[model samples]
Target chain A: MTQPVLEVENLATHFFTRDGVVKAVDGVSFKVGAGEVLGIVGESGSGKSVTGFSIMGLIDPPGRVVSGSIRLAGEEIVARDDEAMRKVRGKHLAMIFQDPMMTLNPVLRIDTQMIEAVLAHDKVSEQAARERCIEALSMVGIPSPAERLVAYPHQFSGGMRQRVAIATALLHRPKLIIADEPTTALDVTIQSQILAEVQKLCAETGTAMVWITHDLSVVAGLADRIAVMYAGRIVEEGNVSQVLDVPRHPYTRGLIGSVPSANPLGARLKQIPGSTPSLGRLPKGCSFEPRCASASEACRAAKPDATDYPDGSRVACFNPYSLARAS
Target chain B: MLAFIIRRFAQALFVVVAMVVIVFFGTNVVGDPVWMMVPGDATQEQVEEVRRAFGFDQPVYVQFFRFLADIAQGDFGRSYVHGGSAIRLILDRMPATLELAVVALIFAVIIGLPLGLFAGLKPDHPASRAIMAGSILGFSLPTFWVGLMLIMFFAVMLGWLPATGRGPVTTFLGIETSLHTLKGWQHIALPALNLALLKISLVIRLARSGTREASLQDYVKFARAKGLSPRRIVGVHILKNIMIPIVTVLGLEFGSLVAFSVVTETIFAWPGMGKLLLESIQRLDRPLVVAYVMVVVLLFVTINLIVDILYSALDPRVRLAGKSE
Candidate 1:
């Protein structure tokens, strides 16, 4: 098998504050092969976004990847300094932020930003960079790519702005693209359109993707594989269909069940009994123990390591759904 | 863009007209200019001759009309005590003030911008903290007190530079300024440094805050994410973005320095508009005083207009916003 575009192992990003350390991303492990999309789904504060930022080495002061090995295409990136990390960024790996504005410079023209991205890592002439930027723009379905290139970000609509951002990431045809919910702010139609365009782009360019989002439905449609995160840890990992159709972890089951379409009309969406556990003050044993219905005394006695199931999905639960079904 | 400029110009005209009214009536209301013209031995008839010659004998409203009419012809009347046409005197002295202000502003920008940007980039760095502490002192010390201390240290103690006065002037383009000569440069150096002390700190603070804000902007992060070197990020993105505010503050401060250099100029006796302002106000040289204020008003309007143009040029968002407006 070809090597994956990215391989992350035991990644733990922590935020140190006067109050206490917030374990934003604790022991997240995943891999994305070229041309594959791995959707990381969880509610807000589940560390999905932080995971992407940690991979990009964009985490600011007080928030750091304290422990982990992030390998992009076989090289370890976790311990790289800012300068070394910068060289890897946008060339080997690129990121699309949640707010397109967060990726677009407000004052600069689209072409200036796009071309700069190209020239930053490549020894290309201005003309070649410009050509690449225009091509990237049209590839993402922006009409009048030439005119759009001359325009500032504010001139583009929200959907178009996101397309521009996606286009910029596509400029270098990076091996890995980590999108932090780029379409979450858009309306349903625009979101789907951007998703389809991005997915199509990734497929065409054979670029691997890590799409972080809180929407399971989005993952069901777009992701090849899905990793469900809860309280800074990946609670479930498997093929998107297998995980969505029959989640082994109770947290994954709760997430899938809470989707509005799963519930009967006019009924309150099914909710996991309690809110997410705060990372700093998690339950003694399993992070999800207080919220799981079938949890037992053993579940409260120790944290569960990821258990590999026969079907190839992994769940970190002391009393997983397979056992319950066997009984 | 043209419409914006025209609109700004109209607003400026309104302000200048209002300022004309204030300069005429505001000064008149304080006391009569006629009082300064009177001789102690003059009889009532002699006093009336003095009043008529100076046009103070007319009704207040008529005097205001005549004031407006004289301004229309660009004839600022003769100075009461200075014994010269007010406009010519101001024009003659203008280069000296410009020279002093230009030197000070140069000093301010050279000393302030990099330090400000550096401190802003690393707010917690030891050198940054030291710069901030020095800026506190810069902003705290009174300009005159600072000026005196500068003279004491550089002139009295070291005897390296001259103590006072605009020395050994050179003529250029019909303007007399000491800026061309080494002695002249040395003479203006201490006063210019003194004048720049507060403004330098002001620029440093402005640059620092501007740097902080610009560094936090999304594009800067995007730049970092693009793998651009730190040099490119700070040089191209943060610096260009911060130039708008820094230019604005510099323009306004430069204008104010031109008109309001009373303390710094007086302390160093540099012979600028500020010293002229103090002298004209005391002697009731109404024409000179009004002309000085008008020049100041003109400088302010021109600087603000320049700042707006620069703002639009630096920020495409502003230009696009102007178009939408």
Candidate 2:
């Protein structure tokens, strides 16, 4: 079998603060195959965004990838210096940030930024790079690519800016694209449009993607697989349909149950009890034990190792919800 | 855009008029101009004659109108102490001051921008920390003291460069002029260095803060994620973002250079407008003082206007208002 496009093993990112070390991402591991869209769904501070940033080698001071091996197309990026890592970033891996406006330099024209992105990686002619930029913009559904190229980031609306950002990320046709809540800032209609475009682009180009967002509905509609993270660990992993339909981990079940459509409308929606455990002072044993309804005394004794199920799903819980047993 | 320019010009006109009025009446309030210039005893008729010649004997309103008329026609009256046209004295000395200011500004930008970019890019790096500490000290030290120190180190102690005077420009302007020759630039070296040392610290502080802020911006992070080299990130992406603020502070500093030159030029005895203005003020030359102040104010206003236009060009968000125009 061909190797996955990207693989992360035992990824542990920690932020050393004055009080204590905040385990932003602890012992999280996942992979994305070619043309696969993997969604990492979690609330803020759940380490989902940190995981994506870690993969992109973007963790700055105070927070660092303490121990992890990030393999991009079989090359070890975690061990490379900053200079070498930069060479790998846009050429093999790219990222779309949450704030579209933040992804663009306000002073620069859209064409200049996009064309520069292209020329940075390739020794292409200016005209060729420009044409490629226009193609990328148009591919992302931006109209009048030529005219819009002359416009600045402020000229475009919020949604349009996001599209332009996506266009810039795609300009290099990188092997992997890590999108961290790219659609979260847009309206629902625009969000859906961007989601569909991203999905279609990945499918057609065979680009492996790690979609980091708290929006489960978006994941269900777009991602091929899902990894639900809590307190810097992946509690559940499976195909999207299997995980969303029959969530095994209590936290995963609670998350899906809390969604409006997951439960009946007009009824008090089931909520995941308790907030995410604080990174600085996470509870011992299982991080999710205090919030899990089915957690037993054994669950509170120690964290459970990931147990693979017959349906190719994995759950990290001592007392996972089983449909057969529940019935 | 035209309307904005018109409005800004009208505001500038009001400021200039107000400045002229203050200078005109304030000089009269200082007592008899004749006595102040001639020193010792002077007859009442001599004082009255001096006052009348200056049109001070007329109504204050009429005197102000005459002053405004002279300014409109580019005639800044005559200097009683120097016996030269006040406008001519200003024009003659203006280039020398501007030359020093321009060179000092260039030095400030060249040295400060890179230091700022380095400090910002590596906030925790030892070099950056050292630069930050050094710049703080540089900024806090008085300009005159800095000038004296440069003279002591580079001139008196090392005996390398001349201590004073505006160095001959012809030799410096020549393409073949080398440091080995030490002909013209050697004389300017002390004054220029003195002026730049203080301003460099100011520019570095501003550029460092701006660059640091720009580095944290989302676009910078995005650029990094795209795998652009750190060189490109700092040079192209981060520097451009930081330029707007840096340029603003630099422009203001450039304007202040003219004002601060009063002290530095005096210490160095350089033939610049600051020195000329000081002489005029000491001798109670009202026309020269007014003309000098007016020229400086005009420069400050013009530099600020240029900086504003540059600001919009550097940051798209600023130019958004232009769309409405």
Task: For residues A1-327, write the lDDT of model 2, one tens digit per residue.
Answer: 799999999899999988999999999888889999999999999999999999888999799999979999888889788888877788889999998867888878888788878877899999999999889989999999989988988899999999998888888788999999999989999999999999899988889899999999999999999999999999999999889988888898788879998678789988988888889988778999888778789887888889999988888999888977533
Candidate 2 per-residue lDDT, tens place, B164-281, comes to 8865544345332223335656766778778888878987888888887888899889988877777877888878878887788888788889878888899999888899888877
Error of 1 at A231 (Å): 0.9
Worst 10 residues of 1 chain B by lDDT: B32-41
Docking verdict class for candidate 1: medium
The segments of candidate 1 whose C-alpha lies over 4 angstroms from its true place after superposition are: A323-327, B1-14, B17-52, B55-64, B167-184
Return the TM-score for each candidate structure: 0.93, 0.93
* Residue B2 miss distance in model 1 (angstroms): 5.5
iRMS for all predictions?
Answer: 1.4, 1.3
The parts of candidate 2 lying over 4 Å away from their true place are: B35-74, B170-182
Clashing pairs in 2: A90-B226
User: lDDT at A74 for candidate 2?
Assistant: 89
lDDT of 1 at A240: 86
